[model samples]
Target: MVTDSQSGQGENNKTNENGSLPISRRGAMSRLVSLFLFIGFWTGIAYIASFYFLPFIQIKPGFIASALALVGILVAASVIFMVRVTPTGGSEARTLDFQTLIIVVFGTASLLAAGGITALSLKPPLLAGAILGILIIYVITLFRIIRFTFRSDREIEKIRSQYQDLIKIERAKTEFMTVTSHQLNTPLAEVRWGLESLLSAEGIEKENRDMISMILKGVNRIVETVADINKALSQKDKTATDYASELKTVQLAELILEIVNVLGGVAREKNVTLSFEGPEQEIFLGGNKDKLTSAIKNVIDNAIRYTPGGRVIISLRKEGASAIIRVQDTGIGILPEDTPLMFKKFFRGKNALLLQPDGSGLGLFTAREIIENAGGKIDFISTPERGTIFFITLPLKKTA
Candidate 1:
């Protein structure tokens, strides 16, 4: 049984927002450039400092060059050590701290030792301080490189997590849809058989009329089940950007009328009047046409299912920034406890199940998912044995 918590826009929103990190290719390239540039600048500065300070030792020029070359090699080795010891892409603070410590220790020690030797004849405090300052700047550059690397790594991990979650949710939704579709097949076959039998009957008596009505009800159920499954599948694949497509701005009133016409015969059989009461004006909502139709069908079907000998009223109107669709039914209304779970997949009220034992209990859940995915909200006001009214509010699409 798929629960509402396990299959809806709420889950989708949470997964998209929290489970993924958004990193761009441009950002990655910039970080890589910054890292290499930092390393190059620091290595160059360290080499220059070694060349300048070696002459203070009062050695022969060739010997000073050889000694400075060796010192430069040591400083290069220290930089390599710092890079190696730095953590590979996590929190910047820890990597920065480790790199800073390495640079301070190795850099200060190298500068002081080199200065001590040079000071033997020249005793140039200014030269020593300058070397130390160069090393400090190198350390700072290294810190920037480490921070950028960590941030890049974190962003990559985030993208990976987002894809993983999207896959999981897609799989779960597919499984639920497949299972529900399979479940629907049996009832649909039964309804088809009943309808065929009614068509084959010879006499048109009151008793036969009752049987025909029952068959019609079964057919309605089959249709509703199919619509719910289709809606679920559509919602599973829909993204926010899809709303801007040409298919989303079509007329909604006509779609509702078509659905009502399909189910009208079944409603008549139950003596439950199903109808639409709204403006003739075109009400276009920003969503997939088939998906919105299925959503509305689910709500209307649910109304017809419970409202024995009563009426199911559907209305569509423009209100503020939203298109309001209301499905009100004079049925054996929901209990307070059941109201919360009414939209949960595979969940049915006690009275509802008693009335229709074969209900897959996925209609309301699927409807809610479809509505929410299309940037809408579905809510209800109900009391047991009184009636229920579901208000579906969706954003309106403006067109020239």
Candidate 2:
């Protein structure tokens, strides 16, 4: 039977398989520490040799200023050496991991050398004892560094393994969300179309019609939930590349008119009159074309969904340096309490929720994401029972 430590060594220690003694990483670190200890001890011996000679050497008038200039040059050289030794990962590299130890040891040695130059008249025996004390302190500091380095190496190994495991777990989660969302969406799409057909049919009792409407609403809600999951998972997959970089001149009026046409079915279903008025001159700007289109579409779409048998008027014009998009809707409007959370994800106002129970609560949130990503602003004005107006203001990206 093998002991636990031997079994762990058999699994993790590759050298154990070759019939040789396993050398732990700590052994090499100890050897490196011994070399440093010898260097520091030898430095104290040199300090003693310099004591008598330093007293005999005559002091020159410019010596202090020249010495200060030499120190400044050395400090500048150390900074340059550190920058050159920096790894490809840049400033965060571990090239200067032992900087504190180096600073302490170098400063102590400098103090000892300077003290020897000043304390030359002292007796040899007392001078030897003082040097011994300094060497003892230096040896202790080296030992402390060896212990810290050993522990830190172990911690780094542990963190590396944990980071790898975390990556695998996150990938598994993204795959699961993507697969399930796609599976649910297929059947939900069929159900949505079937409900729309049923709602359009004639010869149904008023009581039964309400029941069908409720069932259709519930189906729509499930579809929206599935869509939210897909969108959430895709956001995790999108990298910095998906964000806008290049710009193209875009006509805001043309885009708004196209969105109004696209949402026509929903407007007709709700008996909401939707219209768009363009500016005198074609409003041109530079932006991410696709993202801006989605932003404008979501805003107009929300206006149609919440309004009950009313009109929505969208107009575009310039306000000083910005192109203003004014969307006025005769909807349920928002309550004062819910006003602050207007653009938050999955946060529907009390009145909006009561109007369309199937609302995903992502419409305004997505709109904000798109507009802000393109460097624009969205604001709103509302009354409790009257109506609401949303304003989208974007700085005109000028063209030559």
Candidate 3:
């Protein structure tokens, strides 16, 4: 039985976080050198056995036994090293340790038993040639194994370092966006409130009222832009539970009606017929109200802007457990080549640019981000020069 003192010493030796004895670069190198020495010693013993003990056994029997043993060892070695090493949980180091054990145990045992028997059973002239061939083969095989092991470890370390750097860069970017969005939101909110107050005053002239209304519209757009930035920032590095505090039940039909009402003037100016269709029974889903409003508003506004004198229809209904919102528009449809990049930030199709050269190309990108974050999906199908249909699907709030 192992003594308690020996057991305690074994436990004390494992100082690494992974419950393994710590090994530095120098210590690993020392182990590698020791491995080479073991290989050399094994080769020497094989040479001695072949030279002195071959006569003791029949040549054919000795050759067959040695061949079988060497084959088994090579198969075992290959199997040991074939396991793919992942970068997680110090697996690379563990693989190295296991490989060392395999090489030392299997290499020594097989060669001591069979290495000389297989090669030395031949005539004297062939004996030297056979020995040299065996040595070359083993040396090359071990060198390749050592090279692959350390090179993979180095590559894994490089990838880990790059991943850490990318994380730092992303966090820094998110912080900058958070700060900029807040700074933009405050001033934009003040401007909107001041504009609304001016427009509401009784003594304001008709022309002045129109101008203030236009300015208010501009301010609202700025506020929406800032809110989009904030939403994008919040969605990064966050989970569903992180958003529980902000989500609330939203009535899909009412929201669609409200967006239609707000965009009515824009549709009229473009001579586009705008309408909303919904089921008599109200459908509700869970999401952030302001963000959802912005998302729907963007889709509808884009429809009106691009449709000109065509019809734009917004509809909402409940299908099983999902609330479906469809915005179908008779507008300049997306080009086939641009489909793959449709929802990428700042991506604009050739047809869309032709329709509105000044478009910021952020509307669809922001819409998808907000909807997806709220456990929803947004997709579209388009036929160039004919029309486009956008579909938004949100999970319906479960009824207890």
Candidate 4:
């Protein structure tokens, strides 16, 4: 039932799927093997010229030995061609440039001319002329390579331009998603507030109360969907930020308290204890406050969502020059296989899907982007049925 285009797209998507170590390793091995083969070919040519040509030359032993040695040096120079040819990975545009081809030709000519002139015992003028011609060809080849290097510089500039455009597009997409989430939240919040007010009225029937509860749950689902989309959009923009100037001294404890307050109601509804446990001392770190806050909130929100009735703890402390933020929860932990993919967009573990089917799976991905952009790292430890703990460490200063 599938067309060729559809099938090809499926194959391309499969090729791009994450964590395929075997394929990458095979590619590296193939490159190494190719390099060895090229080296072997040059070595064989050098051996032939030294063994066969020296006996034919009528020149003195010293001249014959010098010619043979020069042949070996010429063979070694052929290896430099590898620098000009980049691996195309089977792409159509992959090819050797004219300069690369010229380098190979000139190197081969140099070795051949040296061997042929010595073997033929040609006139001194003819031998000198031939050697001079080979030298001139090599000089021209060198000039060509220099010109190609300039071309490559332009290509690099073009690539940078494309990267900037991609950044702009990502920023636009994130801004749109943020606006959309805000718009959706306004209506959902209004409806939920209206329903809660009506539920408080006296003499409301049990049936009506159950209907109101279902409506509230539906509203919450919509809010969560919007949140997921916004999180993904935020992630796109997070990668584009200039981290060096963005990070500044910010209060750690206050940020954690603000995030906990925002998610407090959600925790209360799930009968989970959400609390902060760390030094009350002022902990300051060089970081973008808004991005850091969002990242920490996402971690806390995740903990609250997975933990049914257990405790979720948010801790902050300074370890030397780095700030360490830990979020620990007594919840259904992640599987070993899924731990590495936890921060990847749209990835969900088995237990996570079982607990929350409506999750869009972008929370941790966004959190990772935020932390990484602020020159920090995020890691987690989890065991099934025990709990999960996420650790975020950020440098005290942005190092150049």
Please name the candidate that would achieve the greatest TM-score relative to the true structure.
3
Candidate 4 local Cα displacement, residue 399, angstroms: 14
What TM-score goes with each of the models? 0.52, 0.55, 0.66, 0.60
**lDDT value, candidate 3, whole model:** 0.68
lDDT of 4 by residue, 319-385 (tens): 7777888888999999999876787788888999999887888888888777777767788778899
lDDT of all predictions = 0.69, 0.66, 0.68, 0.69
Better of 3 and 4 by lDDT: 4
Model 2, position 118: C-alpha lDDT score? 45
Ordered from best to worst TM-score, the candidate numbers read 3, 4, 2, 1
Clash count for each candidate, listed in order shown:
1, 0, 0, 0
Model 1 regions lying over 4 Å from their true place: 1-13, 16-198, 201-234, 242-246
Candidate 1 local accuracy as lDDT? 0.69
Query: How close to the true structure is residue 186 of candidate 1, measured as C-alpha lDDT?
Result: 84
Flag the better candidate by lDDT, 1 or 3: 1
- Per-residue lDDT of candidate 1, residues 197-294 (tens digit): 77678787878778787777668666766755665565655665664463456577888889999889779867998889866677776667777777
Task: Write down the worst ten-residue block by lDDT for model 2.
Answer: 1-10
**TM-score of model number 4:** 0.60
Considering lDDT, where higher is better, how would the candidates rank from best to worst?
A: 1, 4, 3, 2
